[model samples]
Target: MPITRRQFLAVAALTVSVREPRAYAADQEQAVFWRAAMPGRNANVLFGYARIDASLVPDIVSDGKRLIDETQRIIAAFPNVEMTAWDLPRRTLPPIWKSISRPVADELRAALAGLPDGVPIEELSGIEVSWLLMGEGQTPPNPYLGDVLARHSRSRGRPVAFLITEKEIREQFWLPRDPIVLNDTIDEPKIAFLLDVRRRVGPIGAHLEQLYRARRGEEIYRFTAEIANQGIPDPSTFIEEEKAGALAFDRLLGLLDSTDAPTAFVVLPIGILTGETGILPRLRARGCTVTPIV
Candidate 1:
C-alpha cells in the first residue's frame, strides 16, 4: 500500500527518535527540552517529545509553544515536512516483510486476524503495522506534540525549517542488513513478546507512559535503554540511521552560524536524547550548554 499522509509523517519520525546515539546515566534527571547554545549566537531549544497521543502531552506542547513563541523559529521533522520518512524497528516495510520467515509471518497474520481494522498482511504500512506488532492497550484519540505543534508552527507561516531532509532519512534506511542477523533479532520469541506488549500495557509501557507524562527525560532515557536491554530488539537496518546526528549536528551548526536568533527542534520519544554519542552532549563539548526547561 502507498504511504498515507500520517504514514509519511511517521516515516520522518524515525529520524526524530530512536535508531541511534548510545550513552547515559540513570540517576540524573536529564531535561528533554532545553535552551541550548554553542559558542555563538544560537540559543536554539530542542523539545524531545513522546509519540503518545494523550492528554498529558498537551502540557508539554504548551511549554513547546512557549519556546516557539520566544524563538519564532521552529525546525520541524516533516518535506520542506513535510519527504515523509519511517518509524523505528519496523522501518522499510516491503523488504522487511519480504524477509519474514514463514512461521513468524503466519503467527503475525493470525494474530491480526481478529482486529477491527486489521487487513491482510500485505496491506499494512507505517504505524498500523508497528502498532499491531508492538503497541499496547489503546491509543488515546488526542494529538501529540508532533501533530499539534508541527502543524501549528507551519500553518502560522512562521520561520520553519528542517534539520534533516526526508531523502537523507529515507536513504539511511536503504543501507542493507544481514538477513541472517535480522532473522535472529526478530525471531518468533521477539514477535510473541511484542504481541504480548500489544495486548497489555506491560510494565515498560506503563512506566514509560508515567515518565513521559511526567516529563522525566533522563528517566525516560534510562528506561528506554532498559527496554532495549530487556529484549526489545532494534533492527540492524537502523545502524546507519544512528549516524544521523553527524548531519543533524552539522546542519544545526549552520543554522546557528547563519542566524541571529534561537531555533527550536522537536524530537519524539524524548529518551532518544540520552545516548552518550547524542548530539546534545556534543554541543556541550563545543561550549554549548543545554539547560532543562520542563
Candidate 2:
C-alpha cells in the first residue's frame, strides 16, 4: 500500500523529537532497522532506473565498488517505504535520448512487453516521459524522447521523471546552448524504458498525488521510476579508457561548472567500468547527492 504523506510526517515528527543517535547494526546482522525514518526525506517510492552509460571519467570517475557500497548505505538509512527495486540492461538499440528519431514507438511497445505491470495508463492521464544518460559528442537525435515523455506526461495528467546526475547533460534546457549535434543517431533504450516507467508510474503517481494533495491541503505530485538490479564492473580505472569515458565526463563536468542544478542521480550499473576515481566525490564536492543502484 502507498505510504501517505501525513503518515510520513508523523514519523518525521518522531525522529526529529528524538535525541539519541541510533545504532546501524543489530544482533550482528548489519543491524537492519524495522522501517525507521531517515533523518531527512522519507522517499515512499524509490524507482531504480537501469543505466546503459557505463563509461567512466578518467581521474574523475570513482570506484564502482564504493559507489555500490555508498548507495547501499543510503538505502539502509531510509525507513518506511513502498519500494520497487528491479534491474534491466541499458537498451542495445539507439541510445535512450535519441530513441524518438527512429520510428520506434511500436518498437518500444514491444520492448516493454516483459516488464511488470506496476502502473496503469488511466492513472497517467496520457503523459509521456523521457529518459537518457548521455550528453555532447555522443548526442542523440532531436525532438528526443524527453519531448515525447513530457508530451505524454502533460497530456495524461501523469508525471514522467528521469533519474540522472549530470547537470551538464540537461543544460540545453535552461542555458543558451547550441544544438548538441546536427546529425546523429544512437541506441536509445533508455528512452524506451523511460516511456515504460511513465506507463508504470502514471497510475500510481496520479493516485498518490491526489492523496498527497488532499492530506497536505496543497499539491504535492512527484513521480518515481523504480529501478532494479544493474551490474557495473570497476569504475575507478575509467581514465584508462580515457578515449571513450573522458570525453563524456569532461563535457559533463563542463556542463556542471556552468549550470546551477548541481544535484542529480545517475542510475547506471555497478559493473560497467573499472577504476579508482569515483564519480561520487566529484559530485559531493559540487554539492550533488549521488544515488547508485545495485
Q: TM-scores for all candidates?
A: 0.66, 0.19
What total of clashing residue pairs does each candidate reach?
9, 54
Q: For residues 1-294, could you state the per-residue lDDT of candidate 1 as single tens digits?
A: 343335333322221233232544433644667777666566777777656664656677777666667766677533332332233343344433555568666666766565566434575542344434433323443675567877767766667667676777666633544433443454445555555554455533444566667767655555445335545433323435556656667766666555555455544244345556556666676777777775
In model 1, which runs have C-alpha deviations exceeding 4 angstroms?
A: 1-23, 77-133, 138-142, 176-184, 188-207, 230-232, 235-239, 257-269
Off by over 4 Å in 2: 1-240, 260-269, 272-275, 285-294
lDDT of each: 0.53, 0.25
What's the CA error at residue 28 for candidate 1, in Å?
2.8
Q: What does the lDDT read for residue 43 in candidate 1?
A: 74
Model 2: lowest-lDDT 10 consecutive positions:
229-238
Best by lDDT: 1
Model 2 per-residue lDDT tens digits across residues 226-248: 22111111111111232324443
